[model samples]
Target: MSLHSMGLELVETVIYLTNTLICVILAVLVTDAWFRGDHKGSLLYWMIAAWVMFAADVLFASRPLLSPVVARILPTLLVTVGQAILLIGARVNSGQTKVTLVEPIGAVVLHAVLLTVFHFLAPESPLRRVSNGLIWATLAYLSYRGLRQSPPVFWRSYTAPAKAFMAHAIFHLVRTVLVLLPLSSTSEALNTFVAILGDLEVSFFMVALFVGLLLAHLKQRNEQLSSALAEVKTLSGLLPICAWCKKVRDDDGYWQQVDHYFRNHSKIRFSHGMCTDCADDFRKEAEKLQPSDL
Candidate 1:
């Protein structure tokens, strides 16, 4: 091979390695959060998706070791499924009405099957590229939808995930249009350009995913800390209490029952119960009580 071609190959490999590292690092970060816990274990899906994308990168790099068919199809399969999994995580985290898991899963499977069929028929066709690009754009759109439509506590409208999704969607759409254009004279150049652009996309996607998801987790964690602080602040200071009535004074300067005070200030709720001393005293009182007193 010419030195120029060799240099390009080296650069491509480096980009793939960089993308792989991003996926692995993201997988580890999300795994920590997943184990620590989030609402509905949503981070579990994110962790899995990160690892899946990592696997895709590994598989693509190991193409020489894989059967031609597997090498061609598996990486794409992983990419599509990873996107679906992210959407699922957002849906789970948001506690939104679910889109039956089968729908998304089935769409991915069917797409994979179609790709496989096309691979056997005319793998190099522009139609395949167009189809692939559109599906990727669609999945990215759905992922954005999942995030934007999530419950207020889970995600804000203006967030990294939203931007990531929009970027991916637009990138794929532009790529599709470029491929669809009948530029016969530039076909070879177009192919080379597309290959380089695709490698860059891989790098950008991994970084975007890592940063976006990391920011998302951090945002959630900050919200939680803020909430805890708010609760603590509410009950922090010395409160004026009625020693005789046992009522606590609230910020409004109105006396309220202890249960009401705690409930309003924090998550605490009262289930009325008697302690051992109180129970014993009550029993004694009952024993000493006459029928008229009762």
Candidate 2:
């Protein structure tokens, strides 16, 4: 191969290997999320998205074995559908959306139909490239928006993922614009450079995104545990109770009724009723006190 051809082959090899590695990492993350038993749906969808993108890379790399139409359309279709699903997953994780089978299933069907129409009706047209890019860009934008709008308690944790999604969206938008540019050797070279840069950005941000998600979930859980501990500590230590009154002394050295103490320290509620023994004792004491003592 010529020097130029060899350089291109090296770049393609690197992209392929990187994508394969990402797919493996994503699979492992998904498994970890499943074992953790939190955010499984979101993690599973993210994993599926990664697998779809990896499959697209595989298909594109094997273009030599495919017919012209299949080679032209299949990879792009996979990528479009993958991005849409990724957005849905991100939204669900951010609590801005809910998981449903219909959206992802519909996205797959829509991508396939669009690619089929583009292949037969307008082969090699900029419309096909533009449409694909636009769809991916839109989904990325939506994901960014959802992450940004996460609840305040979770907003800090989601910051990194939101920024990553924003970066991803920007890259796709740039790609869409590049697709609409006039074709020339110079433009093609620039487009190729942009495509490789976009891929690298995606790889970096995906790693950050998943790690951020895991950290955010752990942080939320930690906060919950801390709150529970604080509550438990409130009722701990030496609580002084009056020998005769049965009232408990609080941290401030103020005596409070037993029912009030428990209600303040915990979620316990009291029913105002004397026990049978206490009721009997009260009755006997009343009988002994009699009206004659007055």
Give the candidate number with the greatest lDDT: 1
> Tens digits of per-residue lDDT for model 2 on 1-294?
778767775786687668667866765776676567764656677767777777877786676678998888887788777777777776777764455556556666776888889889988666776676667666777776766666443345445666666766777788777766666224657766756776676567667666666666667678889988998988888889999989999888999999999998888799998899999999999889969895
Candidate 2, pairs of clashing residues = none
What is the clash count of model 1? 0
240-274 per-residue lDDT for model 1 (tens digits)? 99989999888888999999989888999899988
- Show where candidate 1 strays beyond 4 Å: 1-14, 35-40, 97-99, 151-159, 184-186, 273-294
**What TM-score does model 1 achieve against the real structure?**
0.84
Model 2 lowest lDDT segment of ten: 151-160
Clashing pairs in 1: none
Every model's TM-score: 0.84, 0.72
